[model samples]
Target: MRAVGIAVFLGLLAGAWSQVASPVLRPDCDALEVEEAALVAQDYMNSQLTHGYKYALNQIDEVKTIPRPDGGENYVVEMDLLETKCHVLDPTPVANCTVRPRQETKVEADCDVVLSKVGGVLSVVAYKCKSEPESAEDVCLGCPQLVPLNDTSALQLVDASLGRFNRVLDNDTARFALLEVDRLATKPLAGTPQYLAEYAIIETNCTNDDDDNCVPLASPVARKGFCVAAGTPAFTAAVDCALFTNEVAPVDPTLNGTGPVAPPVVPKLQTTHGLKHHHRLSSVNVPAATGLLSESEESQEVVPVVKRQAPMDTLLELPVVPAVPLPPAAAPVLQLCPGRKRHF
Candidate 1:
């Protein structure tokens, strides 16, 4: 019996050794994609923002990017609109966001960081965003006191820039920027007229060369943008050109349920063919030394101006862009321990 007992113990020890407890090792392929997607998402958002801000604000700077939960980060695109907070994350002490269908997807992101107006005054980045799972067309998301985008005050900047002629709104330079917003996101006008003005500005400003800065209104490459903006059949000719590129088919307007169209109350400036647009004559001698952009050149290249007889469209035309960038040298990063910091 003693020998048998010793043999049983040995067998138990052998079985335990054969199935020894071990740390589970994950395969690279099997690792969850959340982190990777989050990284991509962070980068994607930043790229779009850099593209948006450089054009919208003439420059992009003072970025305070912070990490998100899923290995991503959020940035401070426009930090100035503290009164109404109609902008991106800034002034607010905390920032938050949620992935749709939160239960189905464990992914989420949020960040907290300080914002400052070091360079040019931080303008608000008009967002085509939904504040919560359920929001009405007339109301701003999250903040009740906040006015809807359709409000005159919400778009006061554009109106101020476009409405007055003798006193050109210095900020009217944003006109050329609007169309690129639509091109980048492909979302039609939200409930705001500011977006509409922005669209008009983009279409008017786009040239083959400056699609990076302004939107090409009648480009041969993308008919969808022209289709939305064009009432005349010039769009068809543009579509015929092989240059038009819409990687995906036309989106279904009716796919979603009944929603708010652009609020008529949203202001409308004088547009050719009743479409919110800028029009210029075919023949005009524009100078190239002062960054003065003719309608054609504005869309095609960044050049100087000779300022001829002011056409109707020149009312809100962009002034000569600074031939140079602002704050020539980079600003010092806000360091926690200046000169005393150590890096690992």
Candidate 2:
């Protein structure tokens, strides 16, 4: 059945509900729906603290079948949320390598990602990366040659709000595990502190490269392009693009940009004798004994001017990801559209 009735649709929403699920419909929901949706949406994020992933999100779509406690029967719905994970790095070159210490930051979010309605509840299908296809000659190719080292979703903290969730599975590789989220929360997620609290609980299960089981860094560790306070939302903000911990650079992009050390404990160090022999010293190497420094004040200055992202600007940036009602007999599969603001 359609989420809202035709008569109530107009009064309840700013525009018609899309017939398909897409990234565009992320923000187009009705106000009431948006608020309630935001709550559930946040839970799907799970707290980013323990896992080291900057964002953790799984939408209704990932709910292959919902085993609701209230009774009747399992509900089928699609849910999903987009999470942005950014970290900081020195971006300097040292001899044959470049390294940026890892820092982790996570956020709760509800932006332009599909959240379909099932029995009056809004949700989304989980995110899954398609493996790279093999050329005509290679029939044995199995997975993507490269996977993102950093993972993301709209509401990481909210997902943590749930008791214990394996939002991302395959505990081995950087594979994305899209799981159901609404099933974990005990309350309706919507503009409430309780909702935020629980979501943080879930985010802890998220990981950068599949292993959400790794140990967490101290106050500051980073990856990709971000960092966090070691706690929940109080630790980081999506809008604060400039605030970041040192992140290590990827060695071989072909190897999927992951290094042996998930988060390096000690970064660069300065040796007393190293400075004098600048020529003999590797280009950007910091002597391990001295321990400290990167990105000169002159170089760091560029971050505020260029890398400082517009936090508020991104909030309203994109239109909601549409979720149009399925055609009577047409296939139920959904599609995504970027700027067109709609999808099939």
Candidate 3:
């Protein structure tokens, strides 16, 4: 009897192992439920991006499923994505946005997403992605690559680059302050790493004095521009920038009869390079860097210029008849309507 019981137990153990090792049927990539799970992962991935264009689903490459003992299934999904024209913060939904053309600054990515479905509800477990510029298939070993905006070393490089820019600028009328960092990257090569950055700057109210705390002006007279800076290990930086005057006048915080409010200020960051903060405003007129604009910034619309009429007191009354009459054929017509005096 003891031998028979032991045999039954061993047989039951083998049966359980067989059930656990059973092959899981892969889910159809085109299936509705599978598509939904993949989309959930895609949306989650897009939400995590803080800069540049949003990625749109290109194709669902594969989907694998594993059944759980508690009636839940785990989905492993792989998908391809292309950069879309719509920015990440744009009001347009990702489903409605169109992908960027290949000739443009297109970027592509391959993403792997894991999800779980339990009790008729699906939730994303985690996802990972690898993205690269479409044209950078053979990127140089020490070339710039896309990196997060908050990268510590990259930001430090940018700060140092800005110091260099200000030190070299020859103007004294205005100093440019950092407005935003559009994109940043670092090349971790052998000797010394390099940094590449694209950013925007605005003319600030502060002077060239190193001790002066300055704020960027928001008025139309205020100048704004975009800049690209590259840094090398030799402590040298190359910067190219363009400046443009804004069309909109400065906003008044007290216009609505409320008390004057202080504008948000960006805290100045210290850098290893003890370079002074002084940048000359360039006189060149150029368009704002549309490519550098994030989802929050839109191109400014041209405001119609309205002609102002001179005060009635300043109007000079002239005789209806011309002071000197010339030949009718060569005479210029001067017709002045009442209350509308023509000023020459």
Candidate 4:
């Protein structure tokens, strides 16, 4: 009976393991679909290089699909291409140097074309591309293939790497402006996954003019050992100097320096009343009567007060002459005169 119980326990363990170890299905896209996606990527590449430079298709290296949680696929297409740019010298009447000189550069580009099924048809949803520098160090290059896992985790790793790269170089304005992802790779490590990335830092605005141009500087840097699906995503990564240590060579002091390595200064609006001043006023003990008074109250209190007085009379001596003007009263005699009879 003990042996039978042991066998049953082993069988149960196997069943649980099988459930946890189920294989993920590969993406539903086929070879024809991959070729179509590559064409789309090629068109995208051409559109980006439309500005004076030209690009020629070299070859489509590989096409692979990464499964999405929402039943979609991300077709990662890798390709190599050559770019040509012309540096035309100004024509002069004396030298007649009108002949334009052209330069060619070779680069590898990886395009991620995302597709999703809609109304029973697979349609393109989103796409992005990263161009590889020609002379970047090999240590900065990511693995050629990505691990067969969820693309969400891989993308999260890429995002974390990008955030760190931006934060680290943000101080140096010239270095920050030109930093871009050159390559990205992923591989399975133990039970988890790791990502490797390369970044190209080029001083694109460099020119001979010291007043307006930045000093020319360029380098390739590598950031590796980014573990995805880790407990702490942001802190679990490392960056190394693939081309230069700590930082690139400092710009020439005589050249138009980028001032200082600091974060962009946002002009703060000046305010008459600031929070510190408000707090300071609140902390002081002000008399209740003086609360409404302003700073000019002291000057108003120093003015002299005017005294009011009664008016003086100028006609005081004229009243004594009125008493003598009333003379003594005289007696009058009454005469008895006869009146004539009235005629009828």
* Candidate of highest TM-score: 3
| lDDT of candidates 1 onward, in order | 0.24, 0.26, 0.56, 0.34
What tens digits encode model 1's per-residue C-alpha lDDT throughout 199-221?
22222444333334544445433
Candidate 1, which segments miss by more than 4 Å at Cα?
A: 1-38, 45-145, 163-344
Error of 4 at 309 (Å): 99
lDDT of 4 by residue, 2-111 (tens): 45444444454454444333322222233455546655544433433312223334445444444445656444444443332211110112122121111111343333
Model 2 residue 150 lDDT score: 21
Model 2, C-alpha of 127: deviation from truth (Å): 10
Per candidate, the number of residue pairs that clash is 14, 84, 1, 0
- Superposed by TM-score, candidate 1 places the C-alpha of residue 269 at a distance from the truth, in angstroms, of 32
List TM-scores for all candidates, in order. 0.20, 0.19, 0.41, 0.23
TM-score of 4: 0.23
| Candidate 1: residue 266 lDDT (0-100) | 12
Which portions of model 3 show Cα errors greater than 4 Å?
A: 1-22, 136-344
Q: Using TM-score as the measure, name the better of candidate 2 and candidate 3.
A: 3
Give the least accurate 10-residue stretch of model 2, judged by summed lDDT: 274-283
Misplaced by over 4 Å in model 4 are 1-30, 48-57, 66-73, 84-103, 117-124, 136-344
Instruction: For residue 16, give model 4's deviation from the true position in Å.
Output: 10
